[model samples]
Target: MPLVLFVDMDYYYAACEELRHPEAVGKPMIVGTGDTAAKMSGVVESCNYEARKLDIRSAMPVAQALRINPDIIYIPADHDYYDRMSGRLMEILKAFGYRMEVISIDEAAVDLDSMSYEQGLVQGKRIKEEIRKTLRLPCTVGIADGKVLAKIVCDSAKPDGLKLVERKDIVQFLSEKSADKIPGVGKKTAEKLEAIGIKTIGDIAKSDLVSLSSAVGSFGFELFQIANGIDESRIVEHYETLSVGRERTLDATKDVQKIYLLLDELSEEVYREITKNGFRFRTVTAKARYSDFTDKIKSKTLGYWTDSPEILKQTAKALIRELIEEKPIRKVGVRVSSLEMGNKQMKLF
Candidate 1:
């Protein structure tokens, strides 16, 4: 039996400032673009719990945040500093010897397969204490039999708290929630469920198999399973992304020559990035968007991986030509995938 724990750092960027400058602890602090003339026009990346009281939130443009409270303290986001702290947190958790998976820059899940549910609860509190003691930062931990269950528990226990949903209590915990609480049930879908009188997780649990599947496809049944506290997904440690790419938008045009020029520009930039990253890729994909926002893609799989800029550019150009075939386009992108490290140029999988 795999017991899982999810630890999520509370208001990470904003908390970092409080940890470094104790004076900022009880005040509203914002992490955003630097103090330039356009500082107020920039984006707010994160804000402390104090700032949130005024409805200031992440992704709210700085201008709006200032309008809420002019006296709010602002600091430029230092991604390097945040990344260092995030790495340190992961290192601390990894020391616990669980099979760990980083959920994001500020969240992670660990498998406690060797321990019983009770043991996991004790270990979860220990982890929370160690992180606070070692980093002077606050976080919340959720413990459960699966990742999704742990995530739901963790989300509910925010602003520094710990929660547990043991195997036996999973269904009861889920039953008290809405259909939207199940992953993949977004606002629109939840409305659809509500329209059909499926308001709660328990409603979803008892939904008609045919109608539910028709409503949301196979995922609907999966949602039903989740409502019943079933999630077979594993705690994977790594995911190898198969591609790296870039895209650009321009005024819509029917001129094939103009499209070719855009493709050449994108190809060169993609090649530059690939070389800079020391990656060799065997697949080239070219994608285009029409004026109507419709998109299409064409790809070429090389028999052998190559780091040569010439080959990459040529393949990208050829794929772009074949894809558009003189059709009008509003945007174009080029990417190389099936990547490998160094000069090996051999597919690892």
Candidate 2:
């Protein structure tokens, strides 16, 4: 049996902030998306364990977090810096020469095909140590026979911890866990299972396939397999880019000129990246996030693909105009999708 290692950075954004400002270590801190001048208006992107203990959470309004802890530290998000750190982390993982899948900016799964469980544990510790020594960031690792199980184990041992679930122990390890503990079992799926008196992984393992299938459709088979400690999920080594985009928070404003200027700037940034990558896009999208956190989006698809900045800017402006009429926007974004490689452009009939 193959073993897979899932690595997840602990409180990634907050950890990155602490790396740069060592004084903030062990303090309740959050990395948020609001402007520095009025951080309370923004949303929490990530928070440290200290903040978690106070019931603060990601996507909670910063104002609500402040209400929870009046003195919690706040750091605005720096996505560019975080991306650089993520690149370095991936490079470190690459050095191990194992087939790896980048799960997210802060998570990855590496295949250790046919490796013994004992050796997998040793490699897990080495990975944890390398990330800590080089990046000064904490991470957790979970080693199991399958990627999903590895990720579940990794999630259970968080904030600088490691665990390995050998094939022999997979059933017992998963038996008592809630069905929701399975990756794809969200609230809706859990509700469906509950309706059929299935509440635990053990229940699913023993469930009648016909009933389980009736409850959740085709996904029921997957749940049944997962509950039985059988996982067929594979590590996808490459993920293609489907879109390019950028967003920024700003002082609350309805000023059309200021909004348009920012939109133009964002469009140019998107244009530069797509052009650099030799992609010509047929769709442009504009997004507006209101002061109260509600958002609206509009998209326009062109009749043909082109790499024209003017069309990108003009289409974005037109789309955003319909959104901004309702309220003062606190943030705006632009995206280009339906992408085709410039070299792959098709001839018109």
Candidate 3:
């Protein structure tokens, strides 16, 4: 049996803030966007567990969070500092010398190869302690037979915890979890499963392939397999960088002119990086995160590869215009992919 370990940092952004300002450790605090003097116009990027108790959440308007707890400390987001911390965290994980996949800035999965479950527990403890001692941060670790299962277990044990679920106990462990608990099963997908009377993982385990497929298309096969304790997801040691992108949170707004202005700035940044690396891309994708934290993405693949900044700006603006019409956006991103090295003399088409 393959043993995988998933590590998730606790309340990552807020926790990073707490590290530098210990006085704020036990207080209700949030990291937000926009100028600190005008924080009410921004949105919460992250909040500590202390703030969560008062119903604060990421993407909530800072004004609303303040109404929930007037005394809550607010700090504007400093992504550069967080990125530095993430770099250091990755360095520590890499030292463990196991095949790993970084899921996000605050989460990663490591393949233990042939380690037994008992050995996996010991290794998990070692990782937890190393991170605590080195960075003064708390993290949770979950060990299981596969990546998805390990991630599920990790989430269940948060804010400094470690858990191990053996193969024999996988089904019982997953039985009561809602269908939406699976990583890729979002609210809409879960509602579809609910319509068919498949409310829990246990229900899916007992369901036939035809019934599951009829509800969620081809994803139902993976859902059924995971519910039955079969996860074939693997950890890759290396992933080729495929995209150049930039994103930022702004004062929540639906103004098309303001959004287009920001998109132009982001496009310039992305174009600089592309030119610096001698790469031309054929695809432009625009991403928008609404105030409710739901994200929508739009992509356009050009017929020809080019490094033209005008094309990048025009394509991104058109895509973003489509999404901004749905809701007020708190964050926006521009990405270019389908890359190839371009000669210095390549035409800017």
Candidate 4:
């Protein structure tokens, strides 16, 4: 088993704002979802704990956030800015070892199985401290046996905190927490588990495999393994690029046909990429981000794999209709995955 290190930032956008505006420290601060700060069209992309205490949170509408904390300073997001700092931090990590994976823009998974326990702990602490000192940002780092457990540990150690999960303490740490606290278990799944009298991770860990499978499909089986502090997924240096698609955060408007045209345009872009690479996809997935920040994904499998823009657009349009809500749409995206060479022919020559 590989030892993993997970680094997570605390109130990332809010912290970035505070770095520029020192006065915003200790005051409620939030990052606006889009260019505007008015209406339900714009949501809070991130907010400090102070803002969160006032019912201002990430993904909450700016209008609603203002109602909660009127004095909050709104900052626009700058992924480019964050990216520059993140790159510098990764350069520092590269000096330490090669078995590192940048999981997200802000977080990463690093393997330290080659080092001793004490050596790994020291390296983890150094990475955490160095990031703060170099970037003037707060990060929480966790050390555990695998990626999922490392993330759980990092979640527990927010705001420049660090926690090391030894093999002996993994069971105790997971058991005391709620199942919802597990990485992949969302609100719907948590509620379902709660209905079955399995609220805590400990209960899920102790649950019978047969009953667990019957309750929540394969997710239950995965959750069961997680509860027992077992994760086998390794950190890959580079994962394949799945798909590339852009979505716009549209304003609240009653223009269904216009939205359809936009979806077609996006599908055309995806089609170009697949054709360029000679890739044919079996599945086309469409995502909808509602004005309220609620999102849903719907996918349609094709009878025949093809890299045709016209066909992709048609499939995407169908998916959009089924998943679309009557309410205003904030964002939309199309993705084509499950890609491979078009067909294989075996002939005796």
- Each candidate's number of clashing pairs is 0, 0, 0, 0
Candidate with best TM-score: 2
Q: Name the regions of candidate 4 deviating beyond 4 angstroms.
A: 36-40, 239-349
Summarize candidate 1's per-residue lDDT along 1-349 as a digit string, tens digits: 4778999999999998887877778888788854344477678999999999888999999988888888888887765467557757877997998777766778888998757878888998899999999998999999877787788788878989998887788888888787786656799888777877888988888788787877777878778777788866688763123355777777888787887787788778777766665667888888877765556889888897788878877888788777664557887888777765564324354
Candidate 3 positional error at 281, Å: 12
Clashes of 4: 0
Per-residue accuracy of model 2 over 237-333 as CA lDDT, tens digit each: 6422346778887899999889999999999988987786577899888989888776688998899888999999999999998997767998998
Model 3, position 64, has a per-residue lDDT of 96
lDDT winner, 1 or 3 = 3
Q: Model 1, which residues run further than 4 Å from truth?
A: 33-36, 239-349
Model 4 residue 43 lDDT score: 75
Write down the TM-score for model 2.
Answer: 0.75
Best-to-worst order by TM-score is: 2, 3, 4, 1
| Whole-model lDDT per candidate | 0.78, 0.87, 0.87, 0.77
Q: Show the colliding residue pairs in model 3.
A: none
Q: What are the per-residue Cα lDDT tens digits for candidate 3 across 126-194? A: 999999999898999999999999999998888799999999999999999998888999999999999
TM-score of each: 0.68, 0.75, 0.72, 0.69
- RMSDs, each prediction? 8.6, 5.2, 7.6, 7.6
Give the Cα error of residue 166 in candidate 1, in Å: 1.8
